[model samples]
Target: MSVTKTSPTTNTDASLLADHEVESTYRSVNNVQLHIVTAGDPDAPLVILLHGHPDFWYGWRDQISPLVEAGFRVVVPDQRGCNLSEAPDGVDAYRLSELSADVCELIHSEGQESAHVIGHDFGGFVAWNVALRQPSIVDRLGILNVPHPTVYRDTLKSSPQQIARSWYVWFYQVPKLPEWMLRRNGMDNMVASLEVTSNSGTFDEETIERYRAAWQHTGVHPRINWYRGFRRSGSPSRNTVTQPTLICWGTEDIALLPSMAEKSVDYCENGQLRMFPNASHWVHHEREEVTEELLRHLSQNSLS
Candidate 1:
């Protein structure tokens, strides 16, 4: 990633009917029609959720039901180039700045003036920009297992171990091979990784199939484009994250450690940290109950 201090963040949530998420669609920063899975009352306070790389809104499955029950209107989008979301053909459309706009449009389209935003992994990355770019549109923020962009850059520079953990990112920088590997060995590896890496094993054959089906789409280039955008994106560095925020880290995450997570509060004017000592990268899934608690705490910060 290039080094810089600037950028911003999309939305609706559509889910499979088995769980009864409402079917909806929204346009992204790129103006592509995208589907979203949403639950809760539109009239209630809004909480829009986002998922990260190699994942979709399903990543928030455990928390969604609980959060909705807790009385927050939750919106979880597939995000640009993921699952039901639009995948613009060219890589240029997948840049971070553009990705940030997707978030903005979703909020603009929501008709609500503001929302509590939550994101995991890449979603967390986008969450930062969304909250930053449109502070008035966001009420609060919750981020799981993703450091601020700049802190992540420091990890790559200062720690060889962190670099090693991020080897997949290097592989993803390639043109087509990463997708090919994922299409083959990558899926099973991801499933296996989920079983051991998270505090609880949420991955099963059925879940993997859903993910696979999403990946089997024609516009996978945009998915790879996110990694490609990293090269063009400014070098990740720590900067002010002004949103009232909560950062959650899975302690056992092979790719990240507590030290990097600790750096988040430096930029955050108002921030809190929650760590899952036994959970890996998928901290929310590993410690579902605790994740729900933090999400509730952050989302309800402005409640009447």
Candidate 2:
């Protein structure tokens, strides 16, 4: 549980970090070291924000300040293989079980029995698994734009529409081609993909450049390995989530269908789903109310 403070890198905005009083630190969790940025008080209720694929800790920049103002100790991590975090070799290393363990160990490292866990895209996949595999470590669950693993797996098998939209998942199974495509032209494809997938103006030039810096810094292989590892990760034995869950979805998501969001709620004992018709896959950025919803969800039965 060793934690070391680190200086801000090119991928991070020093002024924004200073404005929010965000502290960057590295913690040895599971078998790898993860770069995490935390804000707010040390003793406040812990809220862990996990970013999705092709993204790092900066994805949650919009929510951190609001959460901190709401009296939460917000910890956003560049989950393994994304930004400054350690990228372990091999596809097997990125398995869902391994990903879930990292979150659990992170909670323990923070000296908390459980924390409010929130995630988006690939991050949501990890968050769902954390609640399913280790329910005790998650006080509440917040998901954005990703379905439950079982729902997604089952849908891919049964729904033609979902299968069609998820063609990239299979393409990523290829050894090096996918990585090369993502890295070529200074990662122009990766940058374009983000813009095309989200609402207009959701990703401006400055924000896109930050993501470009992170992708160039870490390369795309380790991140693509998450998709490659998915085929090998297999499904979890238990699919139901026991914790109070809040699922926020953007109806215009290009990858995941909104119907999957409805099915995902079926797997939760106590879950609420809010759909943003105007927003795209990046609901947190496009909609201001999402932060309010998340704050309300996390404030329920506050541990403080």
Candidate 3:
């Protein structure tokens, strides 16, 4: 991993969302400084947006305005190792427990005892752990396009189709080569990954370039290290998610099967799954209805 410090440029055009108040700042958590960009009123109920792999806080661009307009404070962070956040070395530093702790401290640092958590892809994986390991700090949970870790582990072992789709997870486990390939061709692969997996025309050229610039930032290796740590962490315990959970999945997701979404609800004491048949892995972007549905779910389960 490159140790050089480089900050990615953000799309500062307010017209991207229109009339939204955005603040970019850093917070010290778990010995690492995390870049947090917040929208909406701080006095409103807190809603933390956790983006998936190969994405930073900007991934929540679409949802931020609607969520804020719905009378909730939206906090999006560059999740420790992505974009401007501190990227600590070593596989142990990227462990799920440590990642969850960063989030726990984030809520406390923001002057909230708990906050509503919404996550997509790998971010969904972290949200699950947060609810399980620190239920008190997560008032409600929203997951997009990623299965519960328990169900995912079992599915990976039993489902051939899922295992086939997840071939990259294994590939990412390889030392150095995956990083080299990711950075090759000026991060064309990273841009392609988003374009191919998302609905047609979901990502414009500018959007793709923004993601490429983020990957160019130093310490992106920890993004891949997340998969490595998961591979080494072995199986997760059979823990029931006690929070009111909403699992919104794109049925057309190529990486994860729809069955995993249904199975995820079984582990939650209180969970609901919303499916989007036409959408792919990037459901939040492909379907605008996602933000509205999420607002309803988040509002319904609010502890405030």
Instruction: Please report the candidate that would top lDDT against the real structure.
Output: 2
Q: Which ten residues in a row have the lowest lDDT in candidate 2?
A: 1-10
Off by over 4 Å in 1: 1-17, 26-29, 185-200, 235-238
Clashes of each: 18, 0, 0
What CA RMSD would you report for each candidate?
Answer: 6.3, 3.1, 2.2
- Candidate 1 on 106-212: residue-level lDDT in tens? 77677777888888888888888777766777788888888888788877899988888878778878878766665566366545545655545466666666666
lDDT tens digits, residues 102-121, model 3? 88899888899999999999
Model 3 poorest ten-residue lDDT run: 11-20
- What lDDT, from 0 to 1, does candidate 2 have? 0.88
C-alpha lDDT of candidate 3 relative to the true structure: 0.84
Ranking by TM-score: 2, 3, 1
For residues 1-304, could you state the per-residue lDDT of candidate 2 as single tens digits?
2222233345463344546388888899999998898888988899999998888898898999999999999888888887778888888988989998999999888989999999999999999999999999999999999999999999999999999999999999988899889978979999988988898899988888778877765578888889888788867778899999999999999988999999999999999999999789999999999999999999985844
If both were scored by lDDT, which would come out higher, candidate 2 or candidate 3? Answer: 2
The local distance difference test score of each candidate is 0.71, 0.88, 0.84
lDDT of 2 at 56: 84
TM-score of 1: 0.86
RMSD of 1: 6.3
